[model samples]
Target chain A: MRHNLVLRVVAKLLIPFILLFALYVQFHGDFGPGGGFQAGVIIAAAIIFYGLIYGLDAARKAMPDRVVETMVACGVLIYAGVGLAGLFLGGNYLDYFVLDHDPAHGQHRGIFWVEVGVAVTVSGVMLKIFYMFASRGRDPE
Target chain B: MALTVIVLTRSRNLFTVVVLAGVYSFLMATALVALDAVDVAMTEASVGAGISTVLLLGALYLCKSEETKPVRKPWLPLAVSAAAGALLVFGTLGLPAFSDPAAPIHTHVVPRYLNDVLRETGVPNVVTAVLASYRGYDTLGETTVVFTAGIGVIALLRRRRKQPGAANKQDAAK
Candidate 1:
């Protein structure tokens, strides 16, 4: 793998585009067919591809384990926090209508934040699973 | 697809099986697109064809490349699967026809959602509006589940590095 110049060069060229596409799917979801779940998986796939071509150590450096672990929790916190905000804004739990002065705008804002939360959590979960399986039975350096 | 499944079942080589599984997933994703479920297709392609294959290959690296033949004939398991399949097929007998306008789903909350989604969420994508707004609580629960699963895997796999240096790595991971 180290001696494979073609794979290394091609992957280097392609990873950024893959990540950009994932972001497109994440943010453009409101107007199209893509969404957080698909975007998150695509993002994780980009990192996984990097790991496959470069090395798991390199991928870990690109996205530290501690940061990924926190992301997994923080995403859920963001989602639940939105729900609490709704409750405090004179609405039922998870009521997006109370997020702003206009109910429609509130719904838009709520959906945006919720989708972001979903994307982060999903990407973190995928990376965690990859790390676990990849590191299994390997001797520690 | 059925032939692929048969080949997958007969093959004892885990590598071939895993690769075939990815192929199967791609086929399934294509089928979903044909059914106009583009989002589901995207998810299946990414998670099923991409990540699942990589994870399966990683698991294979930790163990035998070939599957050992089971000693038993597995008749009980076969009978159970057959019974489950029969039950599922029987259950579908009562379901409304595909795309029927009078179907329970079409007649129920579907109309309301279709009528009000744009006004309610100010999002042109009805699917996104439904998933993130109408079903916000459900999505929150799903996010929680994803977070818990990540934590569970970390707890299961990261605790096994018993060396002193590994302990330092664990602290850093924290």
Candidate 2:
């Protein structure tokens, strides 16, 4: 438990950087080696690190199960909402070019929104999984 | 072959076995990256190296740390594994070279994604466009799988409620 103090501090320091990097990857995906999926996992990994050092109960208390569940639903809703937006604009599903007057900027806007949805869903799912395993059974050690 | 043989033959510690498994996962991740499947490599690294090792360690705390001696010959399992490995190699021989321009994968719907996604979808990154738009249904299914797993975990781990009468009896006894 004493040794875990260093791990806790390290996790605290590293997680913010990891989350920031994930956002960077999400936004800069057009030019680089990452995109929504990778960015999502990176953010999830950072949260998982926090859960590991702080204990599952504590982590769950910090983030809360209901909030994570809501995030998951919101992500899917956001993605579908964007597609519906395109549909409303008289284009097929997810046809972002029809989203605005300028097609190129519309695509950027669509990608940003979609990536946000993906990132939110992925992070929520990751934390949810960690909470599940950590809370399992009666062994608290 | 030699590494597997050593792993099979040695009566080593459980930590060693777990570490060896991690090494094997790392090797698999390297192979995925070499094949230019960066997405697969990332999942392999995160699931295999990060979550799996931690879970295994947690389980180890509840179980014995020593390996039990084998009661029978391991030759059959070895033969089976070798045959499976050979079949896998044979299967890979027919696969298209990584990033081959003329491969069927490149010539099919994938080409549409690579060539016209920018002009059509207006998304600069073709992969994101493909995942989020072209095959959004599949992505939706994958997200559902994650959601289902989360639900399963929560259901399995939730604290059980005490019966009203049982709680009252316990309180009376106290």
Candidate 3:
């Protein structure tokens, strides 16, 4: 794969845009056909493409296992924290109505954070799984 | 699409089967787009067709690439599957027409979400609004489910530490 110049160049050219598009889907989910889950998978796909083009070492460096592991736990924390915040703010569990001074604004804020949580966990889990699978059943480098 | 499925069923090489399964998923995504379920389509494209292929391929690397033929004829399993599929086709007859506005589901709490989402959530995408705000608990549960799945995979597949040259110290699976 490293010797394949065409695939290497094409993947290098396409990876950034794939990431940018994932971000667009993540942040603009409120007005678009994509959201956290789709964006997360796309993000993982870009990294996996990079891994294929260069090597597993390069991709692991780009996204370390520690970060991926942290992301997996942190996303759930962020989501649950939002619910806890709602409870603290005198709203029901997982309530977005009281997240901000204006209920509408609060809804937007809550949704934004929740979607972010979803994205993080999804991408993290994906990368972690990919890494786990790729590292096994082969010679150690 | 049916052709892809047929080929998928007939394929003996596991790699070919995995790739054909991805094609089937892509076709399903296209069908979802035609049905105006763009969000689900995007999910199907990315998760179903994209990552699923890679993951399955990775799993395939762990074992033989060729599927061994069954020793005996599986007539009972085939009959059961055919009967189940027929029941599913028959069940579809009870379902409402595509995008039927007056369907019971549409007439239920959907109206509140459709009518009040923008005003309350300030989100234009109904799916996002519903998933994130209207049904926040469900999304939280789903996120936790993803978390649990990740943990489960790590628990099952993670290897212990070995000598220096055997693994990356930072990203060490072994």
Kindly give the stretch of ten consecutive residues in candidate 1 chain B with the minimal lDDT sum.
B154-163
Model 1: CA > 4 A from native: B160-174
Instruction: Provide the interface RMSD of candidate 2 in angstroms, 1 decimal place.
Output: 2.5
How accurate locally is residue B23 in candidate 2, as Cα lDDT from 0 to 100? 72
TM-score of 3: 0.94
Error of 1 at B25 (Å): 0.7
Best by DockQ: 3
Predictions' DockQ, in order: 0.84, 0.42, 0.87
- Compute the DockQ of candidate 3: 0.87
lDDT of 1 at A136: 69
For candidate 2, lDDT tens digit of each residue in A18-135?
Answer: 8899888888876555666677777777776777787666677778889988876777778778889989999888777777789877777777787777777877876776666666
Per-candidate RMSD, Å: 3.8, 3.8, 4.1
lDDT of 3 by residue, A8-108 (tens): 88998999999999999999999988888888889999999898789899999999999999999998999989889999999998898899999999999
Winner on DockQ between 1 and 2 is 1
iRMSD for every model:
1.0, 2.5, 0.8
Q: Please report how far candidate 1 places residue B28 from its true position, in Å.
A: 0.6
lDDT tens readout by residue for model 3, B1-174:
999989988989999999999999999999999989999999999989999899999999899999999999999999999999999999999999978999999999999998988898899999999998888889889989999999999999888667667556656754
